[model samples]
Target: MKTILIPVDFSDTNTNAIKYAADMGCDMPVKKIILLKSYYTSVYEQILPSPDFLLISADDIENERQKIEVQLKELMKKLKNRCHENIEIETVVSTEPIVRAIHNVVEDQHPDLMIVGGDMGHELSMIGEQIIEIAKSSPVKVLVIPPDCNYHKIEQALVPCDLEAVARLGVLKGLNTSHSWLNPKLMLLYVDPKKKHIGREAEFEASVKQLVNCYECKLHYSEDKNIVRGILNFATEQQVQLIIALPGKHSFFYNLTHSSITEALSLNARHPVLILK
Candidate 1:
């Protein structure tokens, strides 16, 4: 069975991600979902109470684990109810930080994908750094669920292509292997910010046609100044359900996160983004 590993926190992000996962499970090949909760605190050492008063004894640790296990069971029950399938849900309580725990699970469980809840237009901090690290480093594809976005079938996927991204065109064809995304129309979106064609028009069209041959696809050109906005606007206008992006030296992912005043799309996009690196 295919698995999706989700790191759980008590935030709205966790709930939204799980809901999205359950909805996707209805049509996709997702059968097993592993929910992970990492145990960590933000308090400083000096601020912590004395060991005698606050130390977690072995018994206390076990009790706490049991408590969280109950919570996880309840969470799993609720998530399963949200879907129509007989989904098998499991939970893990990690002793390390969330990111580290996720890496550990990836190495051990070999989950098919990991889902993240994206926050919009926020200041960079620990969470931002962790998200960037995971996206660039995860062995499997990483899907980001936008804020307030619900799970649904991907009817048409919006692909923002750069001249340099042709080599990674396999990302489009790979989508056809899945049940949920099988044969969804591929909208090859290219935001021609400048009116000048970079001379890769023919190559782009040919490559797209070859890769997504099993599915219907079209090449779209826009004169919007911003790359990210152009793709989102076009997706919204066309009611595209998924956005696939390739990350590399000259790709939109690199430009957005590497700029001095970064606009992190993985953290800010209003639609689910599949980062096919």
Candidate 2:
């Protein structure tokens, strides 16, 4: 049974992500759906100069906590009803920093995949940072659903590979698990560095073929001048719905700072990009 972790903050975007997950899980053998909510205590209020802080009793905090709990239960019920199935929905409430809380949950739950809503603006919110941090730290795959994305049709997926990382069973499992929703046409695109000789084409083909055997999806390969350009061009030509890529381990910090190839593709391509660690 595949487990999917979705962090919720009661925002409409997060709610949409929950709906998307349920819709996708309908045809898959999902074991559990985790909805995590993190709340911070009023440490800032305590430090504030306002004397009104003394007027608020401990009961006020407890009451707020209870309210959030009830809200989560109601949200779970609504989700179950919407999915029309008793997809196991679990909720966690934490006061830790959102990023730390997410990291802790991923560490403990070990979910197969994570789905989060992306912020459309230029600035990253707490939720956005949590999503990005989880994507970087998570051992599994992460999918950030854009605000207006249509989740029903993820038929064509483009995966750009440098063929550096050794493709493992865990990575293959992530791709196969997505097949339930996507039924994707997999494209393994490689960008030939300008200085390298074109004769290495045979070696690249053999490597890609080995990776292709790991899944049953249709595979295509292309050698382009630029990695990002190749991904965008192919996705545009094929009209793909998602792009999957392995983020390189080297210069992890740099990748996160600069818009990654996957990130760039997500912005420019006609589809979403799933970045797997």
Candidate 3:
């Protein structure tokens, strides 16, 4: 993990993500933390222009930049002091849309990860979906932190395995490769259908076991129809602090309701969800 680019709207809601990034930087090889603020003229501001609306000059833009810079600096200071060790802190204030701004940041910084604060209890709001869409498309990993959940030691985390992708792509193989995973004990949840099909269950389970054998892992199987809810239930029951998911490729799980399950779990996560791509 070299760089983490965090896009903030300068709202109090996202402060948690900012702090979370700082906490992560403490132990990881996180070299840089870029705090970005994307701003634009609002609809109300356009309709009710300032005193010199018609003759708006460069001064207005500079003033806005300075304001955002000040805010970013404050956040930068807070994060810098939070960590016991030193890491680079940068502040970027952009006038582009939030989503586009994020892409631009990623293009420029090439961050290893992106983190954002998410709301709880319902499906992703419009803005949340846009943040998630960026995650879905980004080659880098994206970690979505829930609003109410505080950052603590990640003791145990859950990983849902359909036993297909992990076999073909070795997605789970890279689980411990990243320093950010913190080597938490992993729980692999496999929810099989109540009605069995004549597939290679034994072979699949064997493959799954081989990948997880190096790390402490517990295997689980569920017969629930709603796989998304089933996974979330297990997460809550086990008191897991994290869930790791990879972006989709055409596989058995993807064909069997990919968007619905992945979107629901990532967007409406009760625990912090890390989307590894």
Candidate 4:
């Protein structure tokens, strides 16, 4: 991975993700890190008056943008201390919506990865609430760092998947070519909730092995009524440092039955979850 894009909202959750990215970049072949902040004015903010109950002037908006730029630059300086001197860091302040701003950056720069924070509390920041949407829509891979997750050497990663959609494993081939720094052992987990797909385990293993030949991968089968719980339990037992989520018909996001469960997994996972497109 050569470049990483991170959108900052100045929340405690976002601050943690920024630090995590800085630390992770040191280990990867990362060359540049882009810090983006969106200053888009919502309809309510434009219509509602300030504390003085009067519409803010254009100068006030420019002043706010300047202040945000200063903060972004300060963050870049701190990240530089955490990264190797060779790594280049840049900042971008935009007036477009957060999603649109990210899309423009991706189109122009084609970053290898995007990192975001996952909020675990009910009081979610606007950016935090949109994390899943961003991951789903982003053309590049996205690594989500939970509020309490700390950076650690990624020695092993768990991939909970449906073997029927073996085509999705094709993306894993890039792990060796594009992100050689992330050479962690892989564990492909199949949660057979109803035990209906019993005899096809070996067949699926053969298919998965064919696709992920570049890495050390092992296939595992689990039995549980709740797929989310099953995946979490196995991850805890194996002590994996990351969870690889594939998006497709049998994707991680699809398996998550409800918004609440999705939030629970994304926001509470002890290890970071990498959503691959």
Ranking by TM-score: 4, 1, 3, 2
- Could you tell which candidate, 1 or 2, scores higher by lDDT? 1
lDDT of 4 by residue, 1-277 (tens): 8899999988888988989988887787889999999999876777789798988667878999999998998888888998878889988898999999999999988899999988777455667888767877889898888888889989999998888788888888887786676888999998887775688877887898899988899999898877777888898899999999887768766556559545555645597988888
Taking all chains together, the TM-score of candidate 1 against the true structure is 0.83
For candidate 2, the 10 contiguous residues with the lowest summed lDDT are 249-258
lDDT tens digits, residue span 132-242, model 3: 456666667778887666777777988776665665336655656764445788887776666352366677667767866656777677777877777788888999988
lDDT tens string, model 2, 1-277?
4688887777765776788788777766776898888877667654554565454346766787799899999999987886636578889898776667777888999887788776555444456545556667766677777656656666667776555443531364545555343445666655545634266666656665676665545434555755566667887898777777566652222244545633652465145557676
Give the C-alpha lDDT of model 2: 0.65
Clashes of each: 0, 0, 0, 0
* After superposition, candidate 3 runs with Cα above 4 Å error: 40-60, 121-129, 178-181, 195-201, 249-269
lDDT value, residue 211 of candidate 2: 66
lDDT of model 4, residue 123:
56
User: Best-fitting candidate, measured by lDDT?
Assistant: 4
Model 4 vs truth, CA RMSD: 1.9
Q: In candidate 4, which residue ranges exceed 4 Å CA deviation?
A: 47-52, 122-124, 257-261
CA lDDT, candidate 4, residue 30: 86
Q: Estimate the Cα RMSD of every predicted model relative to the unseen true structure.
A: 3.8, 4.1, 4.4, 1.9
Off by over 4 Å in 1: 41-67, 121-129, 178-182, 198-200, 258-269
**What are the clashing pairs of model 2?**
none
Best by TM-score: 4
Of the candidates numbered 2 and 3, which has the greater TM-score value? 3
Provide the lDDT at 19 for model 4. 90
